[model samples]
Target: MNQVFHRFVEGIVRETDSNQEEREDLYEELLSHLECSFKDYQKQGYSNEEAMRTVMTNFGDERKIGQQLQQAMYPYRREMMLGLSVASLLYAYGVYLSQLLIMGDAHILWLVVAVLSSTALLLLTVRPVSSLNRRLWMNSLLLIHILIFFYGLLLATDVYHPVSIGLTIIASLILLLAIVLVYRTTIYDFSSNRQRSAKDAKRLHFINITTGIFVVFVILFFLWAFLFFSAEMSPAVFIIFIPLVIWIVSYASQMHLLSRQKKKWAYSIAIIQTAIIICLIGLWLLGV
Candidate 1:
């Protein structure tokens, strides 16, 4: 009610990772508890300012209390994800720089992706959105992060330095940890939202796995063509990426549709894109 109590509760809620509704609930709960303590102090003959000061002092430091509440509520999951994800990104940057040194050129696309991924991760880390939107954002970013890091690992092999080798090993481990954290985070989100059914859970798992496999296959197919056979079909090598871009666009559209629960449209998009990708792959194989 008063400024001091309001600010104290606000400080605690600021340190938490919660949706808007949960945050409001937490604020009210904490404020009510403090009010009760303040009233009890008044009943024992303390003045208003004295009661307020005593209440705050007994409650302890706002930062420490907030952190403890955050840990109690989330068990350091957010902290773990943020730390590991940033470390993984740093490892990626290190490996990419090494590739630049070894090959005398770097893929500007990877640099752009790294920048975009970092921005997205930072937004997700600091801003709290609805449950559905948060899940979608996290799912999309983590998938792209894993794929790009894997490609970076492939490029890391171009260098033979001890530092590069060690960085690669550390990066690989970080990648694994990121993947596990993403999976567990997804599960934790689903559990927190008790309205989702077992069927929805299975569908999510299927979509994630299918999407990962489809995108990985597409990337590998293009890499194989460009790396091993580009000399023979140099003209067509760049052209092949046209279909890859189209496939990627289709995938993005499918994900949007799925997020909106438009399963029929999403499946239609996937089917058409797969057919187009297959035709493009056939043309490339035939040197067309």
Candidate 2:
């Protein structure tokens, strides 16, 4: 009976494909289940041979089970491969653009940053080790992507030129606005009923407030750092930073007010935001 049980376990081991640790864990689990079933049969007065036969019969199609286990273990493998492939292609094109924009010149620093950031992005997203890790990774990659792209854009335009810097600021603001709009709208979604929709909207208000404050702090820190690094710090940083502050504050404040059913101040902030954008556009045009 022990020999027969051992043979059945070996059959499963041959079928399973996993690392040593996973294989050992699976082996223990499968062995425990088989033992429980075999003991249950013994309690019914089955002989050893009869119990072994019943256990083996119930085990059923080890090959298929092993394949399913492998698939389950690697649920995100396909998605990771697809996303990483696309990300690589994008970075490749960015490299090409860098060379073309500067007439065969390249920004080695930004190129290195882009490479490292994309690699980290791929590794973190590949396995999703944990939910909190995924969220932190996503937030970090977003900041990395933005900051690197900003630097790359400046490099491509030849950062020594003020016009180039101004253009990068304008472009970054437009991009930031578009992205914030997307995040703001999408974060208040996916409800199956009106009650859930209302609840999600309420949650959206607080979340946007929290995210908005964090973003503002991040931008302020970036501005201070950039200024500290510059021997002769210019106003170009503020050209971008001011509008970003205004837009996010406006958007978040409006969302909060509307969520709390306060319309008057929301409209007031909306008007202020429009004025700020117009003033920034005027400054941008003057610089151009």
Candidate 3:
């Protein structure tokens, strides 16, 4: 029975990419189930061969077990993939819109509306509670992308500033980082042990909330400076926001989902954000 359990566990590890703790738990559960089955067979006065056959048969199909495990481990994989695809399409639209904004052919009011709408759609898709909700949000994202793309084509043929190009580059990078972090954190939480101490979890949550608020302030400051103060857009702005957004998003997701695990990635993201802020401020002070 011990040898059978060992072989069963080996098969599970080989067939799936489950983390060490999960694999062990699954192995133990299967062993317990099999032991119970063998006991039942013994009560029926079956021979050893008959008992083995009965136990194996009662265990159900191995493939079915694998499928069940996969479902349990990754119930959200499909939703995540769908969200990623929507984000990518929206990003492509943003690229188009940037080109239009550069060409000076697109109206600023329309561009603002399109960008804001697309961003809202992206956020909505990121947290839909159901498949129907996700589909609706995805459709909205796709529609916004199409609208932005056409608007961008019109702008590309018009006169616009080169500085707009730099701003677009920065915005696109931030959006890309957002998509990557979302995908990675979602997948990691699904696969990792992610059991952390309450103290650690609280600390992580605090960091996430604080950093997220800070990033929101930075974003608002930029918006205010550009729209209200009439400040010229600069590459430095991108340097500041890209890492800030990445860190905040990563920290928030980790705090919410994987609070118990050692969050090395979250800390690394924070450090990167701080470095970028310092570099941007230093450059501005030097009159560059």
* TM-score against truth, every candidate: 0.62, 0.41, 0.41
Identify the leading candidate in terms of TM-score: 1
Residue pairs whose backbone atoms clash in candidate 1: none
Q: Taking the tens digit of each residue's C-alpha lDDT, what string does model 1 give over 33-130?
A: 99999999999999999999999999999988977887887786777667766776676678678767866777777767865775677667756443
**Could you give candidate 2's per-residue lDDT for residues 41-61 as a string of tens digits?**
999999988987898898886
Candidate 3 per-residue lDDT over residues 170-231, each given as its tens digit: 44444444434333333343343434454455455455544454455555455445544556
Report the alpha-carbon TM-score of model 2 versus the true structure. Answer: 0.41
Which one is best on lDDT? Answer: 1
Worst 10 residues of 3 by lDDT: 127-136
Provide the overall lDDT of each model, using Cα atoms, as 2-decimal numbers. 0.69, 0.56, 0.53
Kindly state the number of residue pairs that clash in model 3: 2
> For model 1, what is the alpha-carbon lDDT of residue 87?
75
What are the clashing pairs of model 3? 103-158, 196-260
Q: Given candidate 3, what's the lDDT at residue 161? A: 58
Alpha-carbon lDDT of model 2: 0.56
